[model samples]
Target: MLLEIDAQSQTPIYQQICNQLIIGIATNKLQPGEILPSVRQMADEIGVNMMTVSKAYTLLKNDGYILTDRRNGTMVAAKQSLDPPFQARFSRELELLLAEASIHQISETMIQEKIKQIYQKFE
Candidate 1:
């Protein structure tokens, strides 16, 4: 895993770690069933406190994004189908986003086309 931390960023260290790891998993930069570095080792590499890395790892585990075993350590878990709560969250986010876009005079087609362009770049 390659993690770069910006100590000057406004985001908290643990949050940066959490967000990057999540993106790594979603983008397949980090593979499922791959063991993550130990929290102490990560802390040493990032020059942050061990507790910060531990907190990020804990958050990932709680979110069902990773599994931690005594022998195998932490590995990415299989991606799960969206649960009802997550589906509701997605709907709420889309509604809020559309409302904001309307206020800004942006149409649905404009938003969707922009998203497609961004997704294409990723691909």
Candidate 2:
């Protein structure tokens, strides 16, 4: 779990932290049941306030990306089946990205190749 925070970014610190953790889980860099650092520990490590880390953790937990237990602390949750709403959101986002690529004059073949490369990384 190497988490980096950009103090100057327009995004909120907690959102950035949540995004990175989500990426880690998606890439399998953080496995299911892997324990995450305590909120205070993560705050100290990232040089952010404990509240920021807690907010990120809270978001992750709410999204079913992580779990918290009184005795076991926090760990990655097992992957769940994607619900219809999640699938719809994913489709919309992919459409927006493809539209942007098209606007930038990225060829269809190139866009497909990039998608393939990224998809392969998850494997």
Candidate 3:
């Protein structure tokens, strides 16, 4: 996995890792059963602290985006759930995003086009 981190970005290091892994899963760049690097190895590879990588992995596991087994190591999850509680949270986040875009005067057509382009990637 090649995860790019922007130290200057407002997002924290762990979140950048989490976001990239999620994107990898969404884009089919990472498949179910694909093993990921160990915390120490990933830390060295990305020049981040081991704890940072561990935090990211833990969050991903909790979010159902990845799994870890002692024998096989960490790997992507087979599927992500869309439970009702999670759906509500997802909707709220998306609504906030749209509101921000609207505040910036982003046209609805542009947002729809971008949404379609991104949604097609998961197909």
Candidate 4:
């Protein structure tokens, strides 16, 4: 997976790495059980500190997006079905977004179109 880092962005480098990896998984760019680059290698490639890459990997592992093993290294985990609490949180976030769009006078069609555009990025 090709991860692009924006050093100047407000988001931290580790978070950017995690976000991109998540997108890669969502878009099928990174297949389940595929091995990711080693932390040292990824850090060298991305021009970031090893600790930054390690932090990203740790976050992914903690979130169950990736798994690390001594023999196998790191690989993407199978996608898990969202449970009730997660579904509720997703719904709440979506409602907030829709509410903000409505306050801005964005039409339903326009909002849907925007969502489609964002979703297409994952594909």
In terms of TM-score, which candidate is stronger, 2 or 3? 3
Model 2's lDDT to the true fold?
0.93
Residue 78 miss distance in model 2 (angstroms)? 0.9
TM-scores, all models, native as reference: 0.81, 0.90, 0.95, 0.85
> Top model by TM-score, which number?
3
Query: Model 3, stretches more than 4 Å misplaced?
Result: none
Write down the lDDT of every candidate, Cα atoms only.
Answer: 0.90, 0.93, 0.94, 0.93
Candidate 2 residue-wise lDDT, 40-120, digit = tens: 999999999999999999989998999999899999999879799789989999999989998999999998898899888
Residue pairs in candidate 1 whose N, alpha carbon or C atoms collide under 3 angstroms:
none
Clashes of 1: 0
In model 2, what lDDT does residue 87 have? Answer: 93
User: Which residue pairs does candidate 2 place in steric collision?
Assistant: none
lDDT per residue, candidate 1, 10-113, as tens digits? 99999999999987887778888988999998999989999999999999999899999999998898887889987998899989999999999998799999
RMSD of 3: 1.0
lDDT score at residue 4, model 3, on the 0-100 scale: 99
lDDT of 4 by residue, 32-119 (tens): 9999999999999999999999999998998889999999999999987888977898999999999998999999999889899999
The predicted structure with the larger lDDT, 2 or 3, is 3
